[model samples]
Target: MIKAKSRPFLKHGKPERRPDLMNLTDSRIIGVYGAQWRGYLQYYLLAHNVWQLNRLQWVMLTSMLKTLAGKHRSTVSKMARTYQATTDTRHGPRVCFQTSVERAGRPPLVTRFGGIPLKRQKKAVLDDRPPAPMAGRRHSSELLARLHCGRCELCEQRADVHVHHISKLADLAASGQPQPQWTQLMVRKRRKTLIVCPTCHDHIHHQQPANTPT
Candidate 1:
């Protein structure tokens, strides 16, 4: 059933010679295979028939190899031999195919296929979330990654960077009240939150006092 469902990614009686991927780089080709296979396994982690994915594994491995072979104008056996590598997992070292891309200022992205253990994972988290707004989720991820560059937006302080947030943009420019320097900065940047270091954050809070109970 899985094979039938995946027929579009395969060729008739020639799943090992995918000409469709001839234009992609080896890293992209290999990464796509790894991500798809991992996602499928994660989704079916609780199924009793989880071991059945080994069959899909062979199917995808062949297609990934053949796709690379087509790109390099080489034979499947040669491509397999070239990219074959051993990766260590909780289940021990497993043979897989790998591809890499080195960047000038960052670590290389090393992608692999077929190192995952085909074992039952009763406690694995399933990737079965219902669709919802992705904007907030994406914003959090971007913000977390931004923390590594820990430079405050105010005072140019590199230590103790933090954020100052307003509930809404309207709060930053309440009807007749004069905008504070912090509010002016947030308005200039057109953001509801301001990134600051420890000292600047204290100053901002001192100026923007909390409202008293009515």
Candidate 2:
């Protein structure tokens, strides 16, 4: 009334404010949505054996999703719950995860520190003693005495000049052939010839054709 000079036909003033009532409901939806999506992603990666991403990668991805959604706490809790549920079902009872030795009744056969078995030590001690000085022709003494280092007649080697049988005794016995007196003569006469380096002995046996006459 008092000269309200008709407010000069004001065009657009500030629009009226409207509160977003959907925010609360939208937060829950986002929580559930994030949980399902992240769970599926984790499961798929595990199934296909893709282990390239570390924990930090996963955290970064979830953090980004939560920031974009604008409801970080709710989404993280939902994702955690989903992860727990999936792990429990897919991986079996957590308590069952254990080392192989724990499952077996005996102590681990191997140890971090190298330790020889008692049986092996006993065998080694026995081996150190001379081979009962095999009687006749002083074969053991002759082997210990003569036989200077030289290239093996069969396989060339100057080291490890140990005794080697040209034909295995076991193989001869198994062949069902009667041992002739000449065979014994040959064994006794060739005692000097029997000695060769370990490498040469192995090579001689390896080169022999399997079906050759004994």
Candidate 3:
């Protein structure tokens, strides 16, 4: 049997200092299915900074400890979509993670499911009649902060303000000039955007411009 020093990730231990947050001193010998898996997880998490993960993301990752690759992909897809998370494939197969919101002051977290068992991804079918180019990229953090202004842009409502991008993503990607930056901070710029409340964002998406509350 291969001996690997796996951290007690699945252990539900109380915080040593506060009611929330685990102690960094906590480490225990746990049985990994094999040495290869143990090494893969350690490298993946360490490279991505596991200490920065939020509660929901950490919970989702721990739940997949013993899952197979196919199940892992399916679960990851569902969870990523639900959480509006980002996905990447740097170390292995594919890892889906979340980004920090500047307004909320939240930390970022990453979850990787790729290993030896991961399968190749399938390609999406292209439409013969593609839609015209529109700026579909997400709004920048700076732009979002400006739009928020402590209230909804359209109705000026104070609750649950959100930013909406006005341009199509394809146009933005095509136009954005590549900038030199750290791998994590790299991004493409969008030309146009709008910041609005949840209601206004939904209205814009539904093509109901007139019904959108001003």
> Which regions of candidate 3 deviate over 4 angstroms?
1-141, 168-191, 208-214
Q: Give all candidates' CA lDDT scores.
A: 0.70, 0.33, 0.34
* Candidate 2, residue 93: lDDT: 30
Q: Which candidate wins on TM-score?
A: 1
Model 3 clash tally? 8
lDDT of 1 by residue, 156-212 (tens): 656767877776776656635677777777676456666688998888777774651
| Residue 98 displacement (Å), model 2 | 75
Cα RMSD for candidates in order: 14.5, 36.5, 20.1
lDDT head-to-head 1 vs 2, winner: 1
Candidate 3 lDDT over 123-164, as tens digits, reads 423234433221212235345444544455456565576655
Candidate 1 shows a clash count of 0
- For model 2, which pairs clash? none
TM-score of 3: 0.21
User: Which residue pairs in candidate 3 have backbone atoms (N, alpha carbon, C) closer than 3 angstroms, thus clashing?
Assistant: 134-168, 135-167, 135-168, 135-169, 136-167, 136-168, 136-169, 137-169
For model 2, how does the per-residue alpha-carbon lDDT over 94-197 read when each residue is reduced to its tens digit? Answer: 31111111113455321111011111111221222222221223445334432432334334444546655545444433445554433342343433235557
- Name the best candidate (by lDDT): 1
Any runs in candidate 2 off by more than 4 Å, and if so which? Answer: 1-136, 147-157, 165-170, 173-193, 205-214
